[model samples]
Target: MPGGIEGFDRNVFINCPFDKGYEPILQAILFCLIYLGFSPRIATEANDSSTVRIDKIRTLIESSLYSIHDLSRCQAGKKGEHYRLNMPFELGFDYGCKQFFTDQRCDKKFLILEEKAYRYQAALSDIAGCDIKQHAADYQKAVRAVRNWLVSEADIVADGAAKILGAYADFQEWYYERQLAAGFSEDDIKDYPTSELLAAMKAWVALGKPI
Candidate 1:
C-alpha cells in the first residue's frame, strides 16, 4: 500500500494558499491541528524538484488519513489576475485516492474551507452539495472551524474554541518576542520556512500551553 508510513492515522494533509495574505488563517489552522495532537503536513515540507511535484502530493495524500483543503483563493484577487486552481485540483486528487485505493484508504476524512459559505459554488459547481465551512477571512473563525470539525470527525475531546483561540493569541505574542530575541527580524520570522515554523509550534505546545 502507498500509505504504509508510521502514524498515518494522525497525519493531516493541509492544502491552502501559501501567500502572505493567507498566513494568519493558515497559522491558526496549523495551531489547531497541533494543539489537538495531529501532525500537519504540507507541500512545503520538502523541496525536491527532481521528483515530480504531483507525485509528491500524491504521496502526501496517501499517507494522510485526514485532509483539510481551503479553496478560498479559487477566485482572482485583482483585476485580470488568474484564478488559483491548485487547491481544488489537490482536493480532487485526495478524494480520488480515498475512493479508488484500498479499504483502509476509504476511511480518509476531509474538511473543505472557504472564505465565504457558498462562494465556492460559483467556481467549483461540482462540489456544491458538500459542506464547506466559511472562515470569512477571520483567523479566529478558521481556528474554530478546524477545532469543531476535528472534534466531530476525529472524535477528539478539545477545549472550547474560545479557549483554543486564546492560547493561539498568547502563542503569537510569545512567538514574536522569542523570535526577536533570537535575532530574527519581523520579516525573517514572517518568512521563516514552514518546517521551522511547525517545529516552533511543536516546541511551544510541548511547554504545555493550556490548549
Candidate 2:
C-alpha cells in the first residue's frame, strides 16, 4: 500500500527545533526512528511555497499516528532575545487535532521532550500533568528516551539504546570519511539537506549498518 495518512501506522511526525545547535539531537531522533523501522516525517520535507506553513504542519499532524515534540529550545539564549513559541505552538496544534478530531485522530500518541525535567512547566504550565521526558541536551539520553517511548507506544522490539548510540557514533565516523572521499567539502557535508541525510541514513542501515 501507498504511504501517508492512509498508512499512518508507521508515520511519525517530528516537531522539534531546526536550528544548527539542535542538529545532533535531531539526527539522533531520526536515526532511532529509522533504525526501529518507523518513518519520520517533518515539516521541512515539504518545500512548496504556495502552501501556508501552518496548514502544512496541520496536514502532517493529521496524517501521523505518532508525534514527538521537543520543547527544549523554548527559552531564549541571549538577553533581549525572544523565546521561541513555534515548537509549543505546533505541539498545541497537534494536541488540539487529536482532541477535537475524529476517532483516528483522537488515537494519536505524543512524546513531549524538554532539556530538563519540570522546566517546561515554567513556560507551558498547562502541560504539568503530562509525562515529559528530559534529554538534558545529551544525545544519548535523547536516543534512550525516544527508543523507550517507541517501544511502549509502537510495540517495537529493537536494539537497546546504548547499542543504538554506539551505532550512531560509528555511522558518524563512516559518514564523514565517505563524504570526504567523495570530494564533498566540509561545509557541503555539514549543510546537507535533511532529505538527503535521511536517505543516506536509510541506505546505511540497509547495508548491514557497518560499525
- CA lDDT of each prediction against the hidden true structure: 0.89, 0.88
Writing each residue's lDDT as its tens digit, candidate 2 over 34-149 gives: 88888889988756789999888988888889999999988888999998999999999999988897667788899999998898887899999999999998888999999999
Backbone clash total for model 1 is 0
Clashes of each: 0, 0
After TM-score superposition, the amount by which residue 18's alpha carbon in candidate 2 deviates from its true location, in angstroms, is 1.2
Estimate candidate 1's RMSD in Å: 1.8
lDDT string for model 1 (1-211, tens) is 3436867889999999989889989988888899889999899877667988888898888899899999999999899999899999999999998899776788899999999889899889999889999999999999988899889988989999998888888888888889999999988987888888788889999987633
Residue 208's lDDT in candidate 1: 78
Residue pairs clashing in model 2 are none
Off by over 4 Å in 2: 1-6
Q: TM-score of model 2 relative to the true fold? A: 0.93
